[model samples]
Target: MQIREATAADWPAIWPFFHRIVAAGETFTFPTGLGEEEGRDWWLLAEPDRTVVAVDGAGTVLGTAKMNRNHMGNAAHIASASYMVDPTHTGQGVGRSLCEYSLEWARGAGYRAMQFNAVVATNSNAVRLYESLGFEVVGTLPEGFHHPVHGYVGLHVMYRLL
Candidate 1:
């Protein structure tokens, strides 16, 4: 698999899985009914920030990530990234590849650290991946997220130095 900057053309391939993930309301906080145009606007970030895709040998998009500053001005030294792997491609390391790519991108972009502000505590796969990658749970807002099936769950604030 290869990870590369996402182009506008990739949106079409991204939307199907993007829609499924968001609609599932299991991890991401994006509204369940978000539309394609709005999804593109939210995911396809501009320069100084980045959006990327993980693709297979046949050029099938397997996952995507968007990386940017966690906050502006004085807090700009910290970076943040969000990832979504195609459900069909899970367990194939697509998410890990995108995440590793984002970490390198953040380091190369001069970020001093990276923080994930609202990781759903119920998403064990993600929490484990982050922990394996050196991120630690700095805090958890009790019952911060409303998982579709899990009801209210904690939202973890995870962080790591670059």
Candidate 2:
């Protein structure tokens, strides 16, 4: 697979995975019914921030990631990012590649560290992946997320110094 910066035209392709992941309520914290317009504005980075896509050899978008400053002004040295791999393409290393790409983007953007503010604790696969990638669970907010099926679950704040 290949990773590349995304263009606005890629949103249509990204919406499929974005919709499925958010609706599943298993990982990301986006509203289950988050509308396309809102998703577009949230995922498409026009400037300052960066957005990317992981595509297969045949050019099918397998996953996506977005990276930006974790905070404003004095806090801008840290970066924040989110990743989503197409469910149909899960377990094929798409998520891993997107994550690695996001880190590279963060480093190139001059971030001193990367922080993930709300990782669903029950999403063990993602939590494991993040850990394997060198992110540590800095803290957990008890009963922080309302998983559609798992009910209340802790959300973890993960971080890694770049």
Candidate 3:
């Protein structure tokens, strides 16, 4: 697989899995009824914020990630990122590759650290992946996320020093 910066045209391929993941209400905090234009606006960040896609040899998009400052001004040194992998492509290292690429980008961009503010507690795969990648759970908000099936679940704040 190859990882590259995403273009506006990439949205057509990204939206399908992005829509499914968001609508599932399992991991991401995105609202269920997010529209196409809104999703594009949210995912296809501009300028210093970066968005990238992981594609197979045939050029099929397998996953995507967006990285940016966790906060503005004085807090800008801290970076944050989000990832989405095609459900059909899970376990094929798509998510891992995107995450690794994002970390490299963040470090190269001079970020002091990276933080994930709202990782769903029940998403063990993601939690494990983050831990394996050197992130630690700094805190958890009890019953912070309302999972569709599991009801209220914790949201973990994870951090890693660059």
Candidate 4:
């Protein structure tokens, strides 16, 4: 697979899986039933912020990630990112590749650290992947996320120094 910066045209390809993941309410905190345009605006970030897609040899988008400053001004040295993989493409290392790429990008961009503010604890695969990549759980908000089937569950704040 190859990783590359995403273009506006890529949003159409990304939206199906993004919509599915967010609507499932299993991992992300995004509101279910998010509209297409709004979702596009949220994911296709601009300028110094970066968004990328992982694609197969055929150029089919397999997953995506967006990285940006965790806060503005004085806190800009810190970075944050989000990832989404096509459910059909899970277990294929697409998410791992996207995450590794994001980390490289952040370090190259001079970020001091990367933080994930709202990782759902029950998403063990992602939590494990992040941990394996050097991220640590800095804190957890008890019953912070309302999983569709699991009721309220903890949300982890994960961090890694670049």
Candidate 5:
């Protein structure tokens, strides 16, 4: 597998998985019923921010990630990122590769740290992956996210120094 910068053309390949993940309401807090255009605009960020896709040898997109500043102005030194892997591609290290790529990008771009603003507590795989990558749970807002099946759950604020 390889990680590379995403282009507008990649949106079509990304949209199916992105839409399904967001609509699942099990992990991400993204609004359900979001249209393709809006989702594309939200994920494919502009300059100074980055969007990437992970692909196999055959060039099939397996996952994607977007990295950008966690805050503006005085707090701009921090970076944040989000990831989505194709369900058929999970357990293949796609998410981890995207995350590591984002970290490298953040460090090269001079970010002091990376912070994840809203990590669903019930997403153990993600929580574990972030922890393995050196992120720590700084705080958790009780009953912050309303999981479709788990009902209300905590939203963890995860952070790590670059």
Candidate 6:
């Protein structure tokens, strides 16, 4: 899969996977019923924030990610990112590449570290991916996320110094 910065025109391809992921209400905190326009606005980002996609040679979007400052001025040195891989394309390393690219992007942007604020603990695949990428579970907020099928689940705050 090839990773590249996403252009506005790519939104259409991204929407299908994005919509499914958000609607599942299993990992992301986005409103379970978030609509198209709002989803576009939230993911497209602006300025210092960046968005990217992983595509196959045929130009199919296999996954996507967005990166930005973890917080405002006081916490700007730390970076934050979110990722989504097409369910049909899961286990093909698309999400891994996105995470790797996001880290490199943050480093190049002079970020001191990267922090994932609310990783649903039940998402073992994601937790393992972050750990493999050098992130540590610094803390877990008890019952922080309401998983659609898993009831209340802990949310991990994973972090790593760049």
Estimated TM-score per prediction? Answer: 0.99, 0.97, 0.99, 0.98, 0.99, 0.98
Q: Which residue segments of model 2 deviate by more than 4 Å? A: none
Tens digit per residue, CA lDDT, model 2, 76-107: 89999999888899999988898888888889
Candidate number that wins on lDDT, 1 or 2: 1
Clash list (residue pairs), candidate 1? none
RMSD in angstroms, all models?
A: 0.5, 0.9, 0.5, 0.6, 0.5, 0.7
| Per-residue alpha-carbon lDDT of candidate 5 for residues 1-162, written as tens digits (9 for 90 to 100) | 999999999999999999999999898888988889999999999989999999999999999999999999999999999999999999999999999999999999999999999999999999999999999999999999999999999999999999
Native-structure RMSD, model 3: 0.5
> Residue 105 of candidate 3: its Cα lDDT?
97
CA shift of 145, model 3, Å: 0.2
Off by over 4 Å in 1: none
Which pairs clash (backbone N, Cα, C closer than 3 Å) in model 4?
A: none
Could you tell me how far off, in angstroms, the CA of residue 2 lies in candidate 4 after the best superposition? 0.6
Clashes of each: 0, 0, 0, 0, 0, 0
Q: lDDT values of the candidates?
A: 0.96, 0.91, 0.96, 0.96, 0.97, 0.95
In model 3, the runs with Cα more than 4 Å from the true position are: none
| Candidate 5 minimal-lDDT segment of 10 residues | 25-34
**Residues 46-132, model 4: lDDT tens digits:** 979999999999999999999999988999999999999999999999999999999999999999999999999999999999999
Q: Compared with the true structure, what per-residue lDDT tens digits does model 3 show for residues 125-148? A: 999999999999999999999999
lDDT of 5: 0.97
- lDDT tens digits, residue span 1-162, model 6: 899889899999999989999999999999999999999999988878999999999999999999999987888899999999999999999989999999999999999999999999999999999999999999999999999899999999999999
lDDT of 1 at 161: 98
